[model samples]
Target: MEWAALLLLALALCALLYLLGRWLLGLDGDLTLLWAEWRGKRPENELPDKVVWVTGASSGIGEELAYQLAKIGALVVLSARRENELERVKQKCLEISNLSSKDILVLPLDLTDRSSHEAATKTVLQHFGRIDVLVNNGGRSQRSLFVDTKVEVYAAIMELNYLGTVSLTKHVLNHMVQREKGKIVTMSSVMGIMGAPLATGYCASKHALQGFFNSLRPELGEYPEIIITTICPGPVQSKIIHNVFTEDLSKSLDNTGDQSHKMPTDRCVRLTLVSMVNDLKEAWISDHPYLAVCYLWQYAPTWAWWLMNKMGKIRIQNFKSGVDADISYSQKKKA
Candidate 1:
């Protein structure tokens, strides 16, 4: 009887491990985020009537964010460098959602313009009375190898991606502090958590953001109502490839390649909304093996480094071949 019980237990353990492995294979986000999406507060219930200020509102994830927020009945503040693009996005929001023209504000903002951020914050306050959620999504990506890249490119990336984000956060956070409540969501990348070969500057900037917000969250313990959330999405379908900085400040990526393999933008935004409403400190929204690598990075540094080195070689090779650096390893090699 004892032997039979032990065999059954071993069989159950093996079955459980098999099930866990299968589940892990299909996971696109970190465990906490999936939990929130499953059981936490829904964005529709939480965001309605709230004021959300989205930077880079003109295109890519920011544009999608405006649409989703509008659909959910949140007062939207659309901001980007181009007034025309912001207006276009605003028009689309109005057409798709029940939001009136007054509900969607087209406020053109150049995030790199540090001097203008203060005025931008004041304008949102004047219009909305209070800011509920600030989405910092404006930033560029890098595609060149560090040795070939100019120092000015690195400086420009930091100035825009890191410092510009921090500048705006300072102003909006002040307002949140006054109210003792608000959510600051910065769109960081997976590169922030783990280093890659080609995006040295971009990685540094995101790492700075991760470190900054991680520290800032602790300091804001006095204002427990204020939430600082950093979202690290691996790769989503977007036009970011077309806008990546190359070896020189004056140069641009030659071949954008096929970005179809990336996760859908709307799906990423949906997960983001879930993370936001739940006040998750940090969420990794990515499909494996990127998602798998993040886990390895946290729990097994040596193994993660070994895997990254192997993947980084492929990434660098892809870039050199004038294709997307992050194209699927099997697909690239097969082709």
Candidate 2:
């Protein structure tokens, strides 16, 4: 009986110490990231003059990444559904850097069209001879309960977010494998790491990405030169919220959250570039408290779930209120 009691006491003490270390000493978040940074080596191949293909390059982080890569002298290929916006971004890239029209190829692509990925890859290869880095940043977001969300909504998001990314990666993978050197950078999200409210389909799609890339990472052991970086960034100021697909398969333009807290797109892309340059396997880029949530999900899952549940309820309430307001306004306008 005394031995059992002692074992229980020991376990309790260990748990206490771990919590204290994680919360008070800052052991679980940036410190862990710092250790990773210290241990990581910079990629042997520099970014300059490298052929870097960025998808969803029309706006937000993708557009910012294109400009930054251009500044670094990379031959940037911009792809997205918006040809006009892509041309604008291309012009911006050219203005910011010494790159000319020939250096920055604007290849407008619809990620949902999986059949076109091979042709897109061929076009990129034909233009640049080879793609040194492929950034898979094209995806859609969702904001609705699973029960309320249409079945087709789930399929659409999964097709765009998961299958589309996978198809593009496959098209690029063959080229990377043949050359035995390349980098695949994927834009995941905090929702990818853990569950969140009103993002059931979105979370599932991001989780699928995590599983797919992580499984693929180990299989490429023979090719150490090839690197795969998955970036899970917390809310950054972007059109993602405005573009979020709702239960009825309509886009939400409510602007429902406090933009003050969101990180700037440029800042997010800068941190992501640092991770890419360092060849970090995975990175969660965000402000302090938000970035700390990833660690909470990792080290203290039960607590994380409780916190998320509370937050989820609040978000759902806000969403419903916003929807009600919109309906009332529309009715008044009709009257």
In TM-score terms, candidate 1 sits at: 0.95
lDDT of 1 by residue, 273-324 (tens): 9999999999999887888899999999999999999999989888888777
Model 1 pairs in collision? none
Q: Model 1, 284: alpha-carbon shift in Å? A: 0.5
Candidate 2 residue lDDT tens string, 74-173: 9999999999999999999989999889999999899899899999999999999999999999998887877877898989899999999999999999
Tell me the TM-score of each prediction against the true structure: 0.95, 0.84
| Alpha carbon lDDT of each predicted model | 0.92, 0.82
Q: Point out the worst 10-residue segment of candidate 1 by lDDT.
A: 326-335
